[model samples]
Target: MTHPDTRRPSSLTAKLAGLACLLTLAPLQANDRLGPINITAAREAPAIAPAMPETVITREEIERSQARSITDLLAGRAGLTVSNEGGPGKLSSVSIWGQSANRTAVFLDGVRIGSVSAGQSYLEHIPLEQIERIEIVRGPRSGQWGADAGGGVIQIFTREGTEDGSHLSGGIGAGSRSQREADAHIGARQGAFDYSLGVAHRETDGFDACENGGPYTPPCYADEPDNDGYQRDSLQLQAGYRFGEGGHVRVHVLAASAEVEYDGPTNNSEIEQRTIGLSASTGRIGFWQLRTRAGRHIDDQDYFRDRHFDSRFDTQRDTLSLANDFFLGPSTTLTLGADQTDDKLSSTTDYVEDARRNRGLFAQINTRLGERLDVQAALRRDFNEQFGTANTGSLDLAYRLDDAWTLTAGHGTSFNVPSFNLLYYPPYCIVPGLCFATANPDLEPERTRTSRAGVTWTRGPWAIEATAFRSSADDLISSPPPSYVPENVSEATIRGAELAAGWTTDKWSARTSLTYLSTESEATGEPLPKQPRWSGRLTVDRQLGAFSLGTTLRGRSGSENDNQGYVVADLRGSYRVAPDWRIEARVDNVFDRDYEVVDGFYQAPRGVFVSLRYGR
Candidate 1:
């Protein structure tokens, strides 16, 4: 790979040197406590004590980090890997705990959001400006949901009205590569009604997305030296009304449209995604709490080799769910739920089957035994039109050693239905050059079982969490040798460990995480692609009067791409000039480390950005 200029500032040393002087500083007391809450770990309750290992990124963290997209916001978490083709507004994929990208399910406000044909969400297009918080469960919870959650679950919460009062906030930013961004948010709570609205726009004249430099070059690079650019616009709205004591009804709608330039026959592509959901919950009736929701989502894509046209694919899904929670006692609860989803796909290419439906029933029981032990058992059965039926279950146990320590363990089973393209791709051939690729119509669902154990310690201003997990899969899907046709042929095993620690005191706060993973196919004994052997991250921040400064460093071992490891650092600073006005600046890729997450594709070099904001 080549670049315009490799020369860059020593950002790594500068960031470290700047933080070295604040080692003994105090914490920012005005900021809320860093322990974020999780809403996706259980089905019966909206909020519960943490019995499973999870990670949460709050709005404050999102704002402080100055993330541009979902991919940037969740780059280096434990037991996870995010691979982008090049830079912003490009294709991106996320693999959790060594599972395939499709095995990880994504949701927005409890509604499943993704493509029926591809079986995954386009994370790069989700604007961060509308996000309130993100909840990531490190392990599977298939019994609570259904298919496509074989690896883990990620739930994104959009901005909601604040209890403090009505407020309006907006920001504008500019950065390297002719990058520009603008966003506005308005939220308020009045009487029994609450509402929030947000809009965002971002664009960038990005670097060359290819590594080969130009069309004449060999190996892997773009066919042209022209810079690939990207643009996106997003809108989000949420409103709710409360009645009775604890009865409430809510509705959420979000839409995003993006156009990105790339180096291929398809010189440019456009994507439009939209989601609308309605949910209602009743107050405690006797001993049961009832909730029901209905949602619809659409994923549409149009590709252009040039200004003319090339192809298009569109997917739509409708989901309905009803759940009830029965409180048996102060220490026991029973949860029952039913879910249904109908998916339809439309594409330029013909498919044998373009639509499918799924129905599921699930139950769970959670109990706290005495003062130390907590147990949860859940079971689910799903019936699909393509594949007959599947049963998945899970067991979770937790023991509190004392006020500062807790031990937990869990075992679960999960499965994924074959995607539309994997099972129904039609045969086609061009005149002079003949070509054919067959799909496996009889493909079976992939199944996995995972067991994990962990311990957590929290005391004073320090917290630590560690977990070890092992997963085995049957009927693994992959392209067979010469034919390169999809097949469920191999058995696989994956093992990993994740550790996270944090400390805060007065004016200083720091957090760090380390992850180790290994994966193998029992048939070939070769390591899985894109699963890094190790990764680590460190972040430290200091508060001084109305000014705050932070530094982040991340390192990861080479997986399938580059043969060596790489490290990147970033520095951020913000100052509040008035009660509702602030200015912030950030420098990313401080060291200008040249590396690649996708094989033969280079990453971004050093870049700087500045922004000004009003209100939050």
Candidate 2:
């Protein structure tokens, strides 16, 4: 491991030194009245179960925070870690509970969005303006989602036209380091048809460069002569049509393009992707539901180096699902479902043309043990053409202790198959004669067992929650020695605890969270890479008259690996200039912490942005 010189301005150091001053001098306003958090976006029917440890960020929160990207809104959440390879629009990755980025599944309206070829999800392309809400389910969800559910699931639901009225909203903003953004959205709903369209563009210059200078000679420096920065543009369209009363069809389309500049052997690279999906749901039979969906994705990547090499990756998937719910009695319910998926991938890089099919059947029983206790058990069996078969199950229990306290626990098993790149990519020499990459075609799927127990307390206008969780993974996939292909590592483990509390009053609100994690590779006896032991965040918002002010403090511990600890503060303010218009300003990285989320990557410096948002 090496230490890279993160070139930051002197003003950044001063800001860090004055953190205590800023916190004390800032006015402490009274709390603002806020409604309780709710998860209405989930497909499962709502129940008055025990209060669980969870957080919800609504559309209003997104607007007030003025997040530059989707990752910004997710960065400081409990038990989460983010790694970025370039600037704002560059490639970024996130992990939960020490699991790698690829182990976490991302979904848009229940449709998987990651690239099947690389097993990576691009968070920078999603336009926040089009998002309604984000539901983050922490812990294992293998029984419900199948593969890549070992870590957790991030479900993003786009906005839909409501009964209020047709609306249009847009904004433009400019920040430090040549960062700029433009976004717009339009939506309308008629008698039986609803439609929405959105577009966004972002560009940034990034930070200065640094070079690799260490015993490992790992390219650790950020300074590159040709480091130009990154740019991204995205467009999305969605429409839904409703028939008589029991059926509806929805269509979604998304396109994104990004260009990132790296400072190492690889030159600038451009990535472009397009996705189209069609889904239809019907409820004609008694207590029966049927859903069918088809999706296609095209990914193109161009590399700029000696001789130009271009690669194009394309994938198509079709799914059919049917479920029936049986109400045996007043206190018991049973659900049975069957699902099947057909996937195909094609590439121009001389790689293997792969096709896979999956079929699964699942059943769940929800029962009320008594007036104060509830339990749910679910089991699923899946058969894959490439990975053979896997079985997963989950159990959830909730107990209401009193009016203010509740307890809950859950356990589950999940499995993930190897991605195409992990099994088919060509090995290349790193240092002349030393080959650094290898591939294996007979890799076993990774498996995980997850368990969580938590307690929640709600009293008056304050709510607090704490949870402890432990997960053990078997046959963990990793590249051991010189192999680029994944091998089944013996085992790995992650244990962590999270604490969150929020207080709301009449005109002000405050929330804070603390998370501690310990992750290790049982085989190598080394701490996991890029995972920090401690992270914390504090946020405060105040409203006076027609203006509001907010501040956030986020910090992370130094890595056990070769990374350093860094803390950043952010400030934001908004004014209601008119009934339908608002002006907002945000200052990010106020201390300009010279830190890197990834070991060998560049992070943006302190920046400022201001924008005006209007809607009708």
Candidate 3:
């Protein structure tokens, strides 16, 4: 049986059509008793399927990987690139399809979380242990998700309650560079009510993030050699109750507070990220099923140097969403949704504008042309208080050629509004002698047009997927050179190809993936900065009774502005002592390769860690 993203169909013909198209998929049930009805986390069926090229990382996989950070797990995955200024908890960014992080949208438990001033989500502060699942949708998505979706979307679902019982789980660990961590989760479900709560704390004394540099040279532009340290405390809660046979209501909250030390004029930062939302879903309203949510997200950050506060930025986003799904015909379903976001910003520096509102209305259709062909289409209209009206659309098609082969193609359009800092932050220098960045009020919104095609083959124990894609970006934004002023720089084209394969069995499992990316500035005919051309990863695992072992190797080629390429490997093992107890250990950067993910910074040399976990 297949468990889809959206609500199940009410008609037998629609159900049959859905079953035919999903025979090759694995099951991911949102709600067992309610039948695939998820109000808060469901984007669409195609976004989670091969139609749009998605990847799902589950809790089980998270535990097996033994990854210290979310970026470590996400990097080297298909169509993704990650950069870090130094070790963990410093400055980090993830790009999709060679685009900037601001072009990608992120959602945590259905709450869109990000910094309005920086125009990107602070994914570093989120506790990795609290995440239950992640859905990565690649390519442009503004036709379905509205602004700030020029690249794609990533949805993170925090741990939820176990059905019909009470459970407790926790773990503690210590690692290299004096790293330490502890986390606990307690959950229960009784009658119609269910809730899960988690809390985590992590701290580390990191290596020197940057080498001492001359005043006129790079590598942080300062002489600081002390060990940098980082700390974070986080909490998450999810609660829900079923009212009627098909009516459910839920609430979720996530909060994190962190302090990060780096090498710069403003060398330390205090950050806070919090989000809360309430959602309700009803099984039937006449011929339709309905879901609605209201939420508030906050990103607050403060910069400090030597215990003195330097600057502050506080932002708030208020959001409301409504979606209705109905059957249009025997093999077709239509989904219509409305969204509204109000963003307000407060900062130490002055801005020309403090707040803006965005409103969007969209409609999507999923239909089967025949027994072997399926199609999805979407159209959206958005109106912004500052940027005015915009329209976007997308189309995706999938055809089943035989029992083991499938062909897919898609086209999408997306747009991103200029950020508050991009539009109006005044020019200033934190270190007196040098200015970092400036803003332009005349900046225009960025737009992207993307096209992709792919093929998939699957059998009993083997699966493979390959795709080629191209994206044309208009009015791209950049901050270059001496002034570092933000502007609509130039139009660009990004082209790439990706392939992934996996094989599984009872005793052994192996998986591998590779990506080739190319980006060019139409004006200068040169490659963009900081984008790697080739990246790939290989993973091998083995099982022997209660003990398991695995190894992962990741490598990426050099690029326009990147240093010489590097290869890194991780070794991990775990032993199940009892039915509910386990011990795990990992050695990161086993080769101790000294390389920089970004210019003027250093990555971790080598590290070892061990953890003890107890759970149900």
Candidate 4:
């Protein structure tokens, strides 16, 4: 299987197509109608919980899904499952309903991020043009996001500013694989202050990410078919200030860097990622309503092959959070939180634990009863200095059963920790390849218990949400091989069902989704590898008058190690070449299917793209 119909355009993809069109209309504060900040479904916003379901990927659906990472704007959204080993910024894996992929949990706007020697969070170097939104919350949030969370939680928001005036925007584009992009932005808000700044660039000319399998498995056994390219650059900054009245102070920064060319044996890799934050809020403090945050996260990696130097992995994370919300009436609300984390690692191979520290204390309550009911509860406790105490909890409810219908239920608990390459990989390995991998200091930590049940329906504009879930995993973690190390006996039973539907008018809009999953292995009952027991999604959009159009469809079924089942389609359009200017186009894999979610890599067959714009 080889594909690469044409290639040219690498003078760094024409210097990233002269980047700057504010990286295709960067949406710093995209007309703020309250988009991001749902805090992955918890902390505040009336404490959240209608059987916990939150997923917002806006930025106008990432420019109507012209996506190129953030794992192509969250693979299949909501019922989450994204896997990539090749194609565009490579090396990715995400699974949330059936868990695994480091048991999910990632954050940016609220600090968290990843890698204390691989506990996840690379989302292929996160940069969908300095992003403007994304918030996902699946299940089990370790009470308030401590440890890995057992599968749920993702938050990313960058680019913010715009409360009043002062703006200058930009954009630029190109496509196919020779794909280049550019961006730039500027923002303002006078009186109390507000700021935004942006820069973005993307480059491509990639294909042939891996193959030549067998003999010892895992990517390249040689036959390097050329063409494995990628490049990225990013920067984002946001500022804030508001005094007296309801006080506020905020600051943000996001940085990204990348380089790629792959097919194993470290054929080239270099990445740098950073997220920093500082936040403050207040509401006269007396009856309480406060928020505080301080954060830092960085993940740097480097590897090279043939051109010399071959290893380095670095990660640093520092965070602090504090919250206090109490609105005893108006439907009730109460929240109290505390969190601190510090994880450190720097390597050139040789890990036996580079560092760790975690502290958590959480409490939550959300209310409203009588008029159709709604409730929420949460509790958490954690302390770790290299894995020690843990306790988590959650409870949720909702009941309306009328004006359409509503019913929900939930329960949660979670844990997962054991990465430092699963307890110290390569602390020492010697002799003719005696260590392709090894580590497992009596590993243990993977405890979860989750439950959910739901129903929601609306009458007008049509809307619906359905959920069913179950999860049980205990001490599950395996490494397998002649000596891959990592072990913890194993036990898992994941179950899932999800459905979503939407419809709108005032220029048409549509959405759909469905999924069902089951992963097992209570001691080899098998079935659990690269998920997908069934999946589906569809999207449609339109907005005539200034013109706009969209289409999307996705399907899946098959996996217990790639059983073969596929479908993919996409199309997008836009035009408004006046008063603010715009023009856009896209078509990716539109019927050019030959799929594999990952099994010898290879994806991306049909493509076409175009872009140009200025100001929203």
Task: For model 2, state the Cα shift of residue 98 in Å.
Answer: 1.7
Which regions in candidate 1 have their CA more than 4 angstroms from the true location?
Answer: 1-37, 44-50, 213-222, 426-438, 480-483, 561-564
Candidate 1 C-alpha error for residue 453, in Å: 0.7
Query: Model 1 lDDT vs. the true structure?
Result: 0.78
List TM-score per model, in order.
0.92, 0.87, 0.91, 0.32
Q: Which candidate number has the best lDDT?
A: 1
Residue 380 displacement (Å), model 4: 4.8
Counting only residues 3 or more apart in sequence or on different chains, how many pairs clash (N, Cα, C under 3 Å) in candidate 2?
12
C-alpha lDDT of residue 305 in model 3: 74
lDDT by residue (1-616, candidate 4, tens digit) is 1111000111100011111211111111211212233656765443545545656667767876667778766665556788776788777757688787788888888788877677777687777766787777888878877778678888788867765787777689898888988888787888889889989888888887666653344434345677788898888998999887477888898888988787655577778988888988885566677888899898887877755777888888898988888878777778888888988888777676698888999988888788888787888899887778899988888798887778888889889887777677653322245325546777878898988887867666776777889888888886544354667757878888776767667797776666677888788686666777766666678989988898866656667656465667788888887988888898887878866567666777888989887875
* Clashes per candidate, residues 3 or more apart or on different chains: 9, 12, 0, 13
The global C-alpha lDDT for each of the candidates, from Candidate 1 onward, is 0.78, 0.67, 0.77, 0.72
* Shift in Å, residue 480, candidate 3: 3.2
lDDT (tens digit, per residue) of candidate 1 on 269-320: 8889999999999977888889999999999888776766877888999999
Sort every candidate by lDDT, greatest first: 1, 3, 4, 2
TM-score of 3: 0.91
Off by over 4 Å in 2: 1-53, 209-217, 220-223, 242-247, 284-286, 310-319, 327-333, 429-434, 480-485
lDDT of 3 by residue, 1-616 (tens): 0000001111100011111211122211112111222222136421222255667777877888888888888867778788777888877777888888888888887778888777787677878899998877777778878887767888888888966799999999999999999999999999989999999999999888876775434646567888888999999999999876367899999999999888766678888889999988886566678878898999888888787997788899999999887866677778899999999999887788999999999988778888878777889999998999999888888798997888989999988988887788765553566655467899999988999998877777777778789999999886655455767867999999887677777887777667778898787686766777777667778998999999987767667666656678899999999999999999999989887667667889889999999984
Cα error, residue 359 of model 1, in Å, equals: 0.2
Candidate 4 TM-score versus the reference: 0.32
